[model samples]
Target chain A: MSEPSAPVTLAVDCMGGDHGLSTTLPACARFLQRHPDVKLLLVGQPEAVSAGWSRLKEAAAIPAERVRIVPASEVVSMEDPVEIALRKKKDSSMRVAIAQVKEGQAQAAVSAGNTGALMAIARYVLKTVEGIDRPAIATQMPNAKGAATTVLDLGANVDCTPEHLLQFAIMGSALVSVLKDNPRPSVGLLNIGEEAIKGSETIKKAAELLGAAGERGDINFYGNVEGNDIFKGTTDIVVCDGFVGNVALKASEGLASMIASFLKEEFSRGVFSKVAAVLSYPVLSALKKRLDHRRYNGAALLGLRGLVFKSHGSADALAFGYALESAYDAARHQLLARVEQRIQACVMPSPGAVA
Target chain B: MSEPSAPVTLAVDCMGGDHGLSTTLPACARFLQRHPDVKLLLVGQPEAVSAGWSRLKEAAAIPAERVRIVPASEVVSMEDPVEIALRKKKDSSMRVAIAQVKEGQAQAAVSAGNTGALMAIARYVLKTVEGIDRPAIATQMPNAKGAATTVLDLGANVDCTPEHLLQFAIMGSALVSVLKDNPRPSVGLLNIGEEAIKGSETIKKAAELLGAAGERGDINFYGNVEGNDIFKGTTDIVVCDGFVGNVALKASEGLASMIASFLKEEFSRGVFSKVAAVLSYPVLSALKKRLDHRRYNGAALLGLRGLVFKSHGSADALAFGYALESAYDAARHQLLARVEQRIQACVMPSPGAVA
Candidate 1:
């Protein structure tokens, strides 16, 4: 894409995730086996990685040179993301993995560790891109309309200013360019109502800024969208502060769980219902595949100086494998640098310049 | 409850909801038929109410004296919650019903109108309670644990201060006491993490205030609770700003839809899965019943001078019926007066101190 740069190498935090190396190592090995040209720098405790390596080798032959283990003394727990990232776990596997990206040892980094810790490490070491105040994590959400919509600030900056939200919109638009493949992505500010005048004075002001920005052709702002609009694929990018984004993300997950429970009851009502279920099997399978989180493995932390991706904490081998590929794609696309340059090019005189 | 209060009559907005007056009028008629001592004031266009009333008489022999129709000139459309609530037909059923409560002709009011409009009208007419800065809508969410948990600031106040959140906790506890029969309800602040230091400065300050209040036995405060903690039924009342609460509720609804789609796919996978679906019918149905919004209708507009319930805009007959029943329950229980008394008794330093 950018004059065919050398093959990308990613630092994988092997000790991360719920199951740790038991799932991470095999996934990395499998991913390498599938993409021989790609390289991996596995950062974790040596003994644990070695044990997992042995099991992976015994199960299937792996190219020795394609994967290398970089020993690190600590492993950040699921607890206190900020404290561990800042103080206690300076030499942790996650930190070490991030350091590799900062030092140019690897093109990108991928981790299933504590999200806050990952974010903190990325912000502190790699630093925010020029013209960006805070970085945000943007993930692709499967919509009912058979399209994947990007929702950002999934849990980054809890309290955000209008300027911060505008930055997120720009970064998110850049992401959609690389990921969703839309040249001009349609962005919507997540709000209680679609009306421009709806929500708080802060939101109302943000809406005006977004509208002005859209008119200037800086970012494709589609005005305000509501909670239900997320799954309907109403817009390509949905922006919100981390607090709202986090709650929206979790709430969607909760709603999915509730719906699953409801359907199980509906189809089990009678023998006739059971027959209808069989008749609808193919359609249902397609729908499940569409909704599966495993298919969309990683979320990119945008507005940063480097590429960093966060996989689901409960991610298994297949999901983790996808995360690696995602990181490789982000690195090759030079997403971070592209977004930074675009934002810098559009510097405005007022606080609402980008708005 | 407060010496029976002279048979409090409720004005039901019969033209509201998706099912319209066809469902609303019969439900009100049935409710009045069961409670012979209670009077029903149907507020809508007189002809429509009479038509629906005739149907109720044919279906269940509803007594004529128990119900009366107060003609309204118009019906509020579902399109605009704010605009329609303010500028649209002055004689709309929702407005007239609210007017009845404001005029003291009815002790309380129930509406299945646009949520924003109901809130707007309620605030404009009933006004805020004596020491309450804002009126918040509180809903009873039925958790998987087979208990209803009260989640407040559903959609009334989007932006809230620490003092507002603390007041919500106080008001929510009182509502829970009336609805769930929990004398001293456990109140929790919904946050990203459990630790007191986890959220924004606003949340932290609110947590300190809540801690102080809990120490004095004013309300049972359960420290900080995360989004997942909601369905666990860990606390009797969950307090948050309106934005978070609205997103959480919608997200829960979305997640439920997603999960339902997943299970339908799983059940129709094959013959074996189909058989499992049949076997699990009763258990699944029981679970669905627990999640059904119909049974848990009527979100109370707490911290208000009068008892007002906001039913879901998409609610069907059963949910509207529940709204009527809930409004009746709140009036008969003198819920608002109880809340006022509780706040004055607990939070106020002295009898003459401001609430």
Candidate 2:
């Protein structure tokens, strides 16, 4: 795919996440200053955007020419179910933000809303891209290599067939190639053990399909990796069913956060600790930044006809800005077209169920 | 469940683990010193034990009266398959160690062998306790509340039915009750989300069976809990299928170890950093100790007729000693009989396979 010279536009769900308008408006302001060629369609209730813009106008001097307010009557709460968000809330800011991509008004969409509801609305509005049976969530986890590992099927398709996993590998490879600028990003099958015969039947069959695909040069498949491989940066991309992927990702996040909190507690104890905290401030800050999940905030919803990224619901303005930058980068690099072309290039045979 | 005055005896697989006699012998010598009421049956090649005994004899004065040499002609390699270790290596130290427990020669067994081989051999020799369909691996992970959370079915039954999950809850509760001395330890179903409607069909059905068991006083089911809850100390026991449980636990360990190493790297960069490191040495060591997996080395293989605990294959003498203590505690507290009693009281209505 050829890189386009035209400016990229992104639809921002201003009424999403926990802080909603407060965090999103400031994030939009900061994002606009850094990305001169990027334009934003701020989707939210008219009054909320009007009032919120005034609050952020003094602190952030956002260019007026590149910004436009796209009014939506309803907001998708984080607690809303898929059915309610898809059918009931027709004018939700989250759904309308995605609609901008479907209608070609914007090159991509970014939202920090309910993940289940976001997937449901995005799938309904922008159907699966050709050759994909299901869409998957591909997110980055910071690794020891000072980069990130792209892992897919995070809480999207819980019960994935072997073909679905293969589809994920194809979609994930495309996503990583675009994001990392690697022509042949490696893909790994996430399993219990490195051995081929360790996991369940679904994983075994998935391994065979992946191996065959690798031989045909469909994707650069690195045979098998265990959970530690994700953080060890053993491969650029790790693929698994949504159930295990989601749990493993969350558990890692939990442990990392716990360790960070524990370090904070240890530094705040007594006089010696206070001296240690001051003397070790530089090292501690570096360690925190290296381990922070906030810096890696965006998760792409791949296999859809259009591009949409989900930011963490609890992200602050700085973290939300990272999500916007990720979306802008994806759109500028033609991630959607690259993904479609990559899937089209691969032709894997569908395996009949083995008794 | 009565507290008997009989001396607790443990069969040690001296030839197991990466360090073999070097770690196990010192660990056993230290264990015998601390636990004056415990007896050890060290199983290994006859000559190896005889020669190794002299090496440890200088560094440690292990009481001759309290230790017995049990001869095993073969050693189970860490890479041995279940079939090879179970059938081919019939006289393996791992198998003979468990056999001592079966023959009532030792009250319990502790081995740092190939996990799959250990599970298979132990299951074959001891069999599952009455009323249990499968034996599970229950291990503790350190949490925020300065206690460990016990997680079960780790890499044992990859594909578990709803009934099997209920059985795990019952077995886990009994194990925790015996270990923690809490009559009703809270049990949580490890799922993608805490919502009741969130997981796969199998998990949803398992939730129902666990709820029923909770109502009948068979377990202390705390509804559905997500992955983060395990480390948050939200529940005493977290239960999931072996595939998910194994991956989650390993992922946590990988992240924790990565953080520790990163802290070390940051502290060794320059002279100023070295000064900071000296100033923060106590705080750093405290953080390291809090996150260390070595303190929680033993993993109990539950639901077996006799007691068995698996130590980490890479454990050093200090870590292996913790495992021996865990086994000694489990056997002394009569964990096996309590687990059997709990399963018998469960009486969950096993439904036919749901289409």
Candidate 3:
């Protein structure tokens, strides 16, 4: 494959996330500054898009021609059900942005919208890759090894077959190869224990399929790993069903926040403690920087025919920009193509019986 | 129920845990000092038990009659399979300790043994409480609200039916009520989202059962709660299958350890930082004390006919003492009786369909 000389085009869902265009537009402006050879098609209601554009123009040096507004009439609120996102709000900004990717006008799509809606719209508009039954949400997390471990099925499909898990292993391996630049990255099947006989019928059967795929050189399956392995950086990629993945991610987020609050509380307790906090300010900041979630904001919705990244709904401009960068990088590296190739080449066990 | 005039008795598995009698004997010595009216039946190989008892006599004021050595011929190693623990090692220390409770020789049993072996032996010997199909491992986690929330089944049964989740909720609620002395502790069904329509079919069905139970005043079910809610203390009890619970527990542990290491590393970077760490020692110590896992060492293997508390295999003397205290507290509050009553009163939905 030859590198494109022209700028990469990306579709931004302007009316997504908690702050809608307010967060997306400024993020696009900041992203444009870092990625000069890039173009953004901001999709949202016309009036809001125009207003958001004016703010971006005032805030940064984003070129007028490099950014364009694709107006839509409807917006998908975070509370909207999947049915409304799928069939009712056909012209939603989230849907229109995904449509641009489906029509090949944009290489990838980025949204900080409601995750359920974004997944539903992306699946409906772009469809899953051939041979894959369901798509998954793959997010990056900071580990103790000072590298982000990629984990999938963050909350796309609820119940997965062993075949689905095997597919996730393949897709996750491809993702780390592009993101971390490590070909044949180790893939771990997240379970309660590391033993061969541990976990459920589905997990046991998934292990067999993953083991076979590993033997075939499709992925470096590292056998069973526990939840702590995610933060311990025991594997480059961890795969599980959406239910378990989502719980782990949200729980870790909660603990991190609680720890930060505890540190602040400890530092501000008394006069002597305040002085000690001032003396330890730099060290505390270093600790904070090490575990910052914003640096790993984007989650790739894998197995789709096109590239789509889900940003946290409450992400600020900087975090949204990180999501944009992640999506752009995925597109530049032909993440979708790699996923297709790996899935096609991989051997899958019987689905219904294993699960 | 009349208060016991005689001293409370506990069966101690001396040959369990990583440190064997080295950990359990000293812990029992420390426990007997604090709880003067308690007795311990130390079960293990004859020579090891006698040697450990001699050391305990030299260490503290544990009376000879208050601590007796009960010999068992076999030992269950950590790597032993469940079948071996169940059928082969019938006279193992783990089994003998659990048997003491079954034979009314002890009020409760405490072991820091192989989790799989402990659970199998406890189930086979004690059997399940009436109306309960499976046993669950319920452990306490310190929350941001300065209270320990009870979460279960940490890793006993994988691939649980909706009915099993309902049982976990009932059991966890009973646990909190006895431990915290709250008559109607609020219970949260752990899921991906708080909305009624979110989570897997099993979770949804469990919610329905819990909601119905709440309506009947069987349990104060608070509906669906996400992972963050566990640390937020959104409810007194959080219920999930073993797979999700184990992952969440282990992931939290990993993150906590990583954050602590990060803090220490930052404070010890250079000479100036080392001085700063000295000044902030008090604050750091407070943070460490608050998040210490040793304070919450015991996990009650609920649903057994008799009370059995499992300590972490790697616990030190102090941590093991905490597990002993927890077991004593559970026995004193009649935790098993409460569980039996709660399960008998609750209604479980059909098993096959939802999960």
User: For candidate 1, lDDT tens digit of each residue in B82-193?
Assistant: 7666676788898899889888888888988877777777787788776677788899876545577789888788778888888899899988887667798899898874
Sliding window of 10 residues with minimal summed lDDT for model 2 chain A: A346-355
Task: List ranges where model 3 is wrong by over 4 Å.
Answer: A1-6, A194-197, A350-355, B1-6, B194-197, B348-355
Q: Which pairs of residues collide in model 2?
A: none
lDDT of 3 at B311: 94
Candidate 3 Cα RMSD after full superposition onto the native fold (Å): 2.7
- DockQ numbers for every candidate? 0.27, 0.58, 0.60
**Per-residue lDDT of candidate 3, residues B10-58 (tens digit):** 9999898889988888888889889888989999999978976896687
Every candidate's lDDT: 0.79, 0.88, 0.87
Q: Give each model a TM-score.
A: 0.87, 0.96, 0.96
lDDT of 1 by residue, A249-274 (tens): 76565444544545555666788767
Ranking by lDDT: 2, 3, 1
Candidate 3 per-residue C-alpha lDDT over A1-355 given as tens digits, one digit per residue, 9 for 90 to 100: 4564667999999889889877888888888888888999999999979986987776796779888899889998888988887889999999999999999999999998888889888988998887777888899888898888899989887888888998888888888887677988999999986221279999988989999889988899898889989999999999999999999999998888888888899889989889999999998888788777888898999989999999999999889988998999888878889888877777656352234
Which pairs clash in the backbone of model 3? none
